[model samples]
Target: MSSRDTMLARIRTALANGPAPQPPQPDWAAPVHLPLPDAELAVTFAASFRRIGGEFFYCETLAQLGAELRAWLAERLPDDQQFYVWEPTLQALLAEAGVPFQATEAEFKAQAAIGLTSCEALVARTGSIVVAPATASGRRLSIYPDQHVVLARPSQVVAEIGDALRAVQSRYGTELPSMMSLTTGPSRTADIEKTLVLGAHGPRRLTLFLLEDDA
Candidate 1:
């Protein structure tokens, strides 16, 4: 076998008995604050989510947020009962808003779940949402769940991919995590007979809660 093939063989052999490689340690630090255009931020996130076969909502108060969330979940959730998903921060927020909720990390990996969290940055140019794995938004919370609801503050939206990349590099250094998904929309693929299908390997539904603070 060629050198490249030999290396591949060795890698496969090593993996045959070893556990899956753990995701790298993300360099968790704050990004250099750069003020972006306000109207542009709203427009970017709204457009990005829509393009990905998703929906977006804006809520000024926790009450509005909870109401909107319950309404949205009502449609997508199974059966006639309210959805029971796991999100510590989200659960707290829901409770504060007097919305019935519960918490359990054990259920995070279930195929029925919908993950939620506030984001680090929303890149307008690529329509990508950048998330750090170390926060309440655990790596699994974002990837393992079937639906994802991201809460992105207007100030967190960046103008371009380079800016977001620089932000990640500056914070996480060279060895980033096992995954830093630049999720633009619902997971999709057209690999089978050029037929597009959502939720191919990720969330089939993506929703964004864009929060803007009127100063």
Candidate 2:
């Protein structure tokens, strides 16, 4: 037999003598977990997020959140700049506070400078925000705007990505959302000359308003 044929025969014999390989397990079957304390999680997430140019805010109550929102808008946005909010509860809260925001998709697309929405979970391990299509206002609201603001409660924060996934599964059960997004910091890229550029494909800024319970 030729040398190549001899080598092939030896490989075949080795394979025949060895045990069959098992199929890989599904993600849900063998999920990984890493938990953290709530206080440590918030601190770690804030530090990691800020390192990538993300802004963070903490509010003790809805009233404080509204006040902060108004102050931020006044300082950062022009009077004519349009803002969009998707969540109904948030919409009501802002409307009650007399914050001008667009509710219709048409108006939002026409003059949207900032888009505010709620997230499914906040991952403390990677400093990421998990947004599912069904829970959020719309897919485009998070991607098309110049800036994205997330309204999250302290209870929504999880230790890691796996824990976040578990939370989604537990919340939605079999009727999961069509899509889920894990966003970390602002959209940026360092593809050209190794110089970092923000807003390469999506929102240039990411701000998180984390609501805490009254003490």
How many clashes in each structure? 2, 0
lDDT of 1 by residue, 33-108 (tens): 5555656866866686687676878888877877887788777766632244355665676787666543555443
Runs in model 2 deviating more than 4 A are: 1-35, 213-215
All predictions: root-mean-square deviation over Cα?
15.1, 6.1
lDDT to native, each model: 0.71, 0.84
What TM-score does model 1 achieve against the real structure? Answer: 0.70
Tell me the TM-score of each prediction against the true structure.
0.70, 0.79
Q: What TM-score, to 2 decimals, does candidate 2 have? A: 0.79
State how far residue 209 of model 2 sits from its true place (Å): 0.6
Model 2 is weakest, by summed lDDT over 10 consecutive residues, at 29-38
How far residue 148's Cα lies from its native spot in candidate 1, in Å, is 1.3
Best by lDDT: 2
State residue 131's C-alpha deviation in candidate 1, in Å: 1.9
Which residue runs does candidate 1 get wrong by more than 4 Å? 1-39, 80-88, 107-111, 169-178
